[model samples]
Target: MDSVNFELANDGIWTVTQLNRQVGQLLEANFSRIWVRGEISNFTQAASGHWYFSIKDEGAAVKAVMFRGRAQATGFIPKPGERFEFRVNVTLYEPRGDYQLQVESMRRAGRGDLHEAFLILKEKLAAEGLFDQGRKREIKPMPLAVGVVTSMAAAALRDVLTALARRAPHVPVIIYPAPVQGMDSAGKLVQALQDAIARNEVDTLLLVRGGGSLEDLWSFNDETLARTIASSPIPIISGVGHETDFTIADFVADLRAPTPTAAAELSCRTRQTCLNQVDAAFNALTVSQHRLLERAGLRLDRAVACLVSPQQRLQQQNERLQVLKSRLARAASAPHDRHAARLALIRAKLAHAQPRLPELRNELNRQIQHLSTSTQRLIERRGQRLKAASQTLEALSPKNILERGYAIVRNEDGEIIKNALDLSVGERLAVELGQGSLQANVLQVHALL
Candidate 1:
């Protein structure tokens, strides 16, 4: 080796910061702004509002950063593991001497032709009113059975089963097997939906799958599948992917959930929730029955207070008739006594005039005879009036009416029934007759009007 010349001066020898700055400058000079496409991972946003993440493909990954200004202008908050294209500038962090990309702007990746197709189908279906909220069916709060349409081997199926088993073990689950991927999946899914519809065995159906790439999830974007979902009589819940992923099936289904497990939750209420509802209903029914019984008891008490035996009523009327008879007798005797007193006064006046005594005596005898005749006639008339009144009272008596081949009809509650319309068929009625009482069921009712 040749002898080396020593140049140990401060300007000649390089420090760590100087070396890093020089390398950073070199990188900035060599590379201009370029567009890059990759999946985002390890994403973090600092308090200062700078986004820090890594953009990775299958083979490699590179650190990237987007400042607050650019991130705000992008009008989107990026989720981890989403594929996007970044317009970035290659640079190095001088302090750490690390190479990285400064993202100027970003957009969804691989959204060219597939995105256009998605938009076209979405617009067609939306215009056809398939996405209208008014047209969607309501999910049953308590489904008797739940049917799942998905591949048997999918992880999403496992997730759904697990969730349903945990939440609603009492509910039966039926699986309609169909592939959720591959080229022929769309047709198979449509057929499965049709089969579920034809069977009509389940109250709600769940269509679910795990998250995947755009092409991997493309089968769910089929127009025929969307139409099939729309036509399903059973309410369908679509849980096709992660929270950010969406498909045509999601738009057409009756309800949409963010994940497979969420779809299972939406399919029906949990076992505890159903039990709570049942308990509440039972409590309400019990309270209602108690109130009804209380009302019925009060009504029965009132009816009992107003109700009287026919014998007792007849006895009361007989007592009233006796009182009226006594009053009539007293009135008839009072008039007779008054007329006798007037006759006595006339006889005293005749005694005072002795000369005309003989004629007066003859006149007095005739007058007495007339008075006797009038008194007898008045007594006869009073007796006739009393007899007529008694006869009228007897004729109008309820007991006499019942005796004349008539009955007093009453309801089960002991309410007197005056109209046939007050009774209904099969209702029990109490019929009171002259001698006995009978219980009868109404065969029919005829309105007089």
Candidate 2:
């Protein structure tokens, strides 16, 4: 604001090296590891084992370096026009102040954008439940025939044929050729799938292609191809690439094989294995039949043990009848014997129970005589008692008392007057004596003083 301190500010000015170093540090500190996708250009492998290249998209290009350590790990030699995705570090060259990327690793554009698209479609179909294991149909272990969808020129077809011939030569193989690469390859693949399905000749369909770079294999990543595979009624075995490669078709298929040959091996059993199984089944059937015949023989032996001739059966029945006849004769004689014993016992009991008439008559006479004496005694005793009672009653009788010189006087109404006051003077009364009765009249009544 006052005088400019130009000399002082100049003294604080930073050197070029320091400035570039600080800027580089700042760039590295601010930007983490990043990803870049573009066509590779100006690629050179330095004698010092470093890769120098420029990655440019439609609008932008950046210098990039992959050191020997990272470049060798890529396992791919970079081509100028080829596209690649790289994981890189942001940095600036200290000397030139030029910003560039240090590549950590590289992936052929195979799993980059198309892989992302593949992932997106896979996730979408997965969410819609198209990739559900339950929705996938089972591939027949013993298919009647197999349909192949691939280019006739593809080496994968030859590999599949060799595998099927070696493992199961009897199984039929039908080839539906389609371009395995190029712009319209996915459409041809879908048409081939439709053709195989319409014919309905094969139980299993192999959708196969040989391994290639991601761009070369992009047809297998098509959404239409993936949808066609998912919707196909035939069980599809997706053998689109090497073991390390994956495509959208793999996720939607009923089965995914690492290679086309592997898909053939998975589809059916080997001829030797089939023969072994058949021989085992035949041996088991033979053993079962032998055991069954042995059991039948044992059962027949037991039946023979129980079998008796008709003559023996009749002889046994006759013996039983003879025993029964002897028992019947004994049973018939037992009642007569039992009756004889019962009659003997009854005779003895009757003899014991019989009454002796003479003795009974004697006893009856004796009882009658005793009863006569007892009756005479009872009558005499009764007579004496009656005489005594009569004497007592006569003594107690008023007539008897009158006979003893006492008299009963009655009033005129024939009531005995108990007191002299009961008689009125000149009242007539009657007096009854022991022998007679008399009527009297009271001349006067007197009160005893």
Candidate 3:
């Protein structure tokens, strides 16, 4: 036991393939799957349908490959230098022993702080019915007054004031200043909103704030503030942050605006547009009144004209009655005399014409007979010409060709062949006869001069 011999065998250097295989096996055992977030660089698509790229962060980088099949399934190719989060499986090429990631999927990360928050809040509120179309109140066309709840120091307040002044100066604004951010912001905002409602100072309340980071705008996400906004007696318009950013207040409020400025614009109607409409309506009413008055004046003038002097009217009526009496006397005496004179004249003419009456009748009858004979001849000539034209049309008809013993030969595709050169042997053709058609194949073609 004390003299036991120890022997060490010398082995030859390992080949590249063996070393690579060992490395690959170790990598497969250690990192089977992983997720990495980095900027893509040196992207290339080979003719062999393999994608090669490097995913690098500030400190380090790693090689990546997405086979054609996986890349195609992704629906879109990632561009170089674009930042993405990738889910990949770690592996080493057995032959080369290179450490690389085999990417399975990818997605964009951190679009912006506001966008991320917007997405999160939107998903959360959508489940709560705050954005339900059924629950949304319709804004009145003309409100008596509008309450503005915003940070007095905010530039957004100034923009709103300017817009309201220019658009509808008649509608007054009751401003309730609130802290838009930081620790005390939520409490101040809720108090301001409650005050505005308690005082009944406005028909509508605009809760607005300028855009800021998620942390800077954390007050808007307060549960108390959201509940307060939802229970507000007056309709609330929550306009906070940029178009991409969303908050709990946006969902709880009656209306959501992309920006504070947009909220102000939506809160009230423009003075100029309203004034123009009212002026138009007033002008139309005035014109209608003026037209009515003119019509009434014209009716009065006509009434006055019709009420002429009674004495003059009586004299005019007497003159007309006298003329009518004279006319009636003359009309009563003239008709009998005219009738007697006409009877005498007619009797004299009849006596003179009685001898020639029989001769004239005979001459008229003869002339009528000649006219009938000539008309019969002309009609017969026209009938014969018409008969010939009809026969010519019939002779040229396709039905006539079929009646005659000739038939048309058509190809399978319905094209007619007039000459032997138009057909080939073994081609399918149709022969038309008067009664039916025969399907046949062209055995041969022959030409005739």
Candidate 4:
């Protein structure tokens, strides 16, 4: 029989590229964006900033790729063997005819049903006031002893022991053995909590365990165990798993610590803190002692200032009398000494500036002669200036014009009459000539153009 042929059509032959392209389009159109949860593996990044990886569960696996832009937007780079949920698009690689997922985004995987149960239980307990701050008791900052509830063989117990020994060695640690994992661990944990409370040997209790998956930490989420922790007379510190993990016990306990050792540390004051308090107290005492010493020294100085013996008083009086006698003697001779100093200053000045009366008299006589000559010459010069001024005035004088037959007439009001209208008929006028003024009367009303 001839080999069967899977061709595109009888009329036309289709190439491998054409077939792969058509299949890829069909796969892309048929499948919508989906979510896939699995463990990451074979993760690698290219220099071009693209990611290539495979996501697998227990049985199946799929090749996935995230482009540079989408990978950058995810903000997290996935490592091999880490579990994450991926959002992807199903498509075939047309070049190789291979089916793979194009990853859009990725997130850490959720805890599934166990996580849902955890949320429900947490909400229920919170609504019932189990997580209320008012219902929780305060853990003493300085406890006398700390009791731990954990399996003696577990690593959590060892972590708690190490922390207690290092931080608060003075506080005794009482270990109450209890199973920290498995299905039956919750019952044993409740019993241990109850026993610690009844014994009253410790003021604070630590309920701790190492980090694990949600299933491994499920025992601490038991409703009965959380209720018991909340009701404990001694304050409980729950340190279940890592800081990222929170069990029901964490909410129910008086305080929640991130780890087993941290719970133990919370049970009492640290050694360093106690040392700091001691140093502070010592400094306060030293300062107080210094203040007291200063006060005492001040009192002694005041007493010394007030003290005066009889001999010392007599010496002070004698010194004061000597000072008074010296002052009185100086005061008594003060007028004479001041007069003597003034006389000496006058004598020194007289000697420095000795006057010659005969020479001064001769100089004065010569000055008087010179002044008389100078006054005569000045008088002659002034007379010449006055003569010149008189000549100019004579040339510009109206008396000259008046002497040339021009007369200046004034009305009765003493105003010079320039127009005939200003001089009315029968008006008295003063006529000024070259040598004198004559009073006249207007006799006729003579009008002239």
| lDDT, candidates in the order shown | 0.83, 0.79, 0.74, 0.80
Say which candidate scores most in lDDT.
Answer: 1
Query: Candidate 3: worst 10 consecutive residues by lDDT?
Result: 1-10
The Cα error of candidate 2 at residue 402, in Å, is: 99
The total number of steric clashes, by the backbone 3 Å criterion, in model 2 comes to: 1
Q: Write the per-residue lDDT of candidate 1 for residues 205-238, one digit (tens) a residue.
A: 9999999877889899999999999988889999
Candidate 4, residue 257: the lDDT equals 99
RMSD of each: 27.0, 55.9, 34.3, 48.7
Q: Candidate 3 lDDT, tens digit per residue, 1-449?
A: 12323233357567677667666666666666666889999999999888999999899999999898887655346677778878788888775667899998676555444434555665677688766767777665567888889887787787777677666666778899998987788899889988998999798888888877556777888767877877777888888888866677887788889887788778877756765675676567557656765675676567557754546655665665567556555666668777567556755754553445457557756865675576567556755765675576456456677888989888886656767888889999999997788999888888897
For model 1, give the RMSD to the true fold: 27.0
Please report, as a residue range, the 10-residue window in candidate 1 with the lowest summed lDDT. 1-10
User: If the candidates were sorted by their TM-score against the true structure, best first, what order would they fall in?
Assistant: 2, 1, 4, 3
- Please give, for residues 135-214, the per-residue lDDT of candidate 4 as tens digits: 89999998878899998767898889888878866667899999989869999999998999899999989999998876
Question: Cα RMSD (Å) between model 4 and the true structure?
Answer: 48.7
Model 3 scores a TM of 0.46
Q: Which 10-residue window in model 2 sums to the lowest lDDT?
A: 1-10
Clashing pairs in 2: 110-214
Error of 3 at 71 (Å): 18
**Candidate 2 per-residue lDDT over residues 161-272, each given as its tens digit:** 8899788766779999999999898899999999999999999999998998777888887878888888899999999878877787888899999899898888887867
lDDT of 3 at 323: 74
Using all chains and alpha carbons, the TM-scores for the candidates as numbered come to 0.54, 0.54, 0.46, 0.48
User: Could you tell me the lDDT of residue 290 within candidate 3?
Assistant: 62
What does candidate 4 score on TM? 0.48
